[model samples]
Target: MKKIKNVRTVALDGLNAIENNQAYSNLLLNSLIEKNKLPQKDIPLLTEIIYGTLQRKLTLDYYLSFFLKGKKKIDDWVQNLLRLSLYQMVYLDRIPDRAVLFEAVEIAKARGHRGIASMVNGTLRNIQRNGLPEIEEIKDPIERISVKTSTPKWLVKRLSNQYGIEVAEQIFLEQLKPAKQTARVNVNKATVENVLELLQKDGLEVTKGEIVPESIQVIKGNIAHSHVFKQGLYTIQDESSMLVAKALDINEGEMVLDSCAAPGGKSTHIAEMLSNTGKVISLDLHEHKVKLIEGQASRLGLTNVETKVMDARKVGEHFQAETFDKILVDAPCTGFGVIRRKPEIKYSKTDKDVHSLATIQKEILQAVAPLLKRGGLLVYSTCTVDQEENSNVIYDFLQQTCDFIKDDTLASRMPEKVAAHVDNGELQILPQYFQSDGFYISALRKKV
Candidate 1:
């Protein structure tokens, strides 16, 4: 573990770790930023370089391939250095090409032999001298989209099959852009208006969210460190995720189960909806994750959230039948919907992973189905646009159980724009749909 001092070095190291599957992009970048103690201004640049390089990795590689035609065994670090330099040179117009090339050569010399630094300099200088390879020349549509958008060809094809090619391309194009920073107002402690005013006073560019009524979209400045957030006035959550608690249709005095809750965003939201009158039992498989739920609950001054360390699939062993008034199975999936924030998912996940997760999602749903009280509501949601893990899973579950039916009232609980997407009580929200995470939410009700 050598020390990472500058933004470029940090970004390069982060990219290498992600490329080797040694770390996830989000976690690795955060760790690197903290370890380096980078300046606030430098943090954005570091984030941009790393995420931009990752978001357009295939495109960058395509551009590099034309230049590195004879090079067969390029070291991962050297390649990453080249990619980082090229990303800044191509995407970041604010930074001149001379500065990017100088940093690349300097970092290369510091880390590798002079010959390697020369090679790095030559590759980038050549790329700068002659523009990147043309992506439009690619004959295949899937390959063109994959390289153009830096998405995997398999993913492009899957989305294309699920959504038409046009919509899938739109989804890819949207994910290439940055994710919006939105937070849910803790209505128990502050009104959306009050939070907006306070955040604005603090110099944050803020506005009401488009989808969820309680959400505030942060246009600029980090809201997590604001006094309002410290006071539990709001919780940083995606606008789409805030819809999960709402879809659950929680009441003031009811036992709600967040079967797979971790880092408890939805659980705390449910607790707020309960107005501290009832308990929201949050469960996660790992002890550390359960602690995350507890930490969030404590931070929000929510005393009604009871956290448990248990596997969601084993809910039958711990709880009696028909116990909870409402349940949320925010089951894990392929995570294709959140690529804008975590670009690694595009290359890391596979079709096999999707099928495997679908199986686990179904198991979690079946395991929790009996625990809901007769006529109790259960909301199934995933941060993925994959139909197999979303609609297919819900449809299969309905076929297996006669006691539950799609809750038609789910539409009424959603925003008008989102409500129109609801079909048979399931809403598959694409990233292009509202510039939100590709999310799915479905409500099911057990027969009374």
Candidate 2:
């Protein structure tokens, strides 16, 4: 029998896998699209449905509770199907409610029994007729934002506490927008102007980055599949990520250490900054991920990057003290800043995780402190907007070490548009500010 391979079915399966923590949404969705050979047109719709379903899951459940009142225990898949359908009916204006309902019923029938199909049909129809409950009715402000934004209440509370309610709401809403694909021009391989023209010639709607000269935002088409990428003319990276390497300001013949470097975006960029003349020793705890740095270095034709499989916390032990001219600690965090790209992170992380990550980040910084040359630079960065993992970690680190002080040169390195955000030495970029991922970057210089 031919398999029922609808876009919604694929989304439902992906949603179940993400909710079960089996795989991340982006990787799983791409894998399914390629494995099933889903139509190119359906790719956008499928991605929207999966991300939308996950992003608005809390809000969907809130509305679902009213409809499912007095009902028996529901299977997880059925619930996921209903959530997927409700996400479309509620958020996606292009997809008609009737079409969404029909597709949901068909998918339920294929995946479950007739009884489940009837429940889906009846529930969705009832939602269409009666509409969802008002979010205003939710009493608690945190819970209200949580449901309305489909963000975890704990996160909502944390953001609100850190940056008042208005900014928190801004951050919450920003995550709902679909993430745009951006890439950095491998200036070593090709000039930015040349790369942009080539990307345009390849039919990509490209635009210059607002914050970085080396970045071009792809308005349409997949740059990864383009012939230009195969030639290593550009690399697919977020605009914020490109800034971390720039903050390091490595000169030719300098030696740099990228602690926690994997999938080597910043590490390779550091190599590119040196005109491929300096060495960038990239380290990651996992040997498998270390290959990613090697692969990226090879792709960009950068000979300066050397990959090593070792814990970032053991850098001092691996290398002699004051050996590196500069170091980058792109520490791992809760990933709160990148919710637009990975909606599942908001649900999986907690306050405890943030503090715990800060601990590890501090350890990495402490261990690598002795490895940097006197007067050398160290850049700390994360994909998250969380204060604890960013400035707090640095502040705590500074209190312990007298050899390092905040490097204010970071402001001069930034584009004029963002120069104002760099205060003293730390910067937190909200995703909405640049229409990019939320990021935090800070720079410190080792004293003589």
Which candidate achieves the best lDDT against the true structure? 1
Q: What are the models' TM-scores?
A: 0.98, 0.98
Whole-structure CA lDDT of model 1: 0.92
Clashing residue pairs in candidate 1 (N, C-alpha, C atoms within 3 angstroms): none
Candidate 2, after superposition: displacement of residue 22 in Å?
3.3
Stretches of model 2 off by over 4 angstroms after superposition = 1-4
Instruction: Write one digit per residue (lDDT tens) for candidate 2, span 1-448.
Output: 5564889888888988887765898789889998778989899899888988888888899999999999999999999999999989888898889999999899888888899999999999999999879998989889989898999888898989999988999998989998879999988788888988988898889888777888888888889899898887888999888888888887999999999899898888888889988799999999989998898889889999998999889876779988999999999899988999999999888889998999999999999999999999999999998898988999999999998999988999888877788999988899889888898999999898
User: Would you list the C-alpha lDDT of every candidate in the order shown?
Assistant: 0.92, 0.89
Candidate 2 has its poorest 10 consecutive residues by lDDT at 1-10
RMSD over all Cα atoms, model 1: 1.5
As a whole number from 0 to 100, the lDDT of residue 237 in candidate 2 is 92
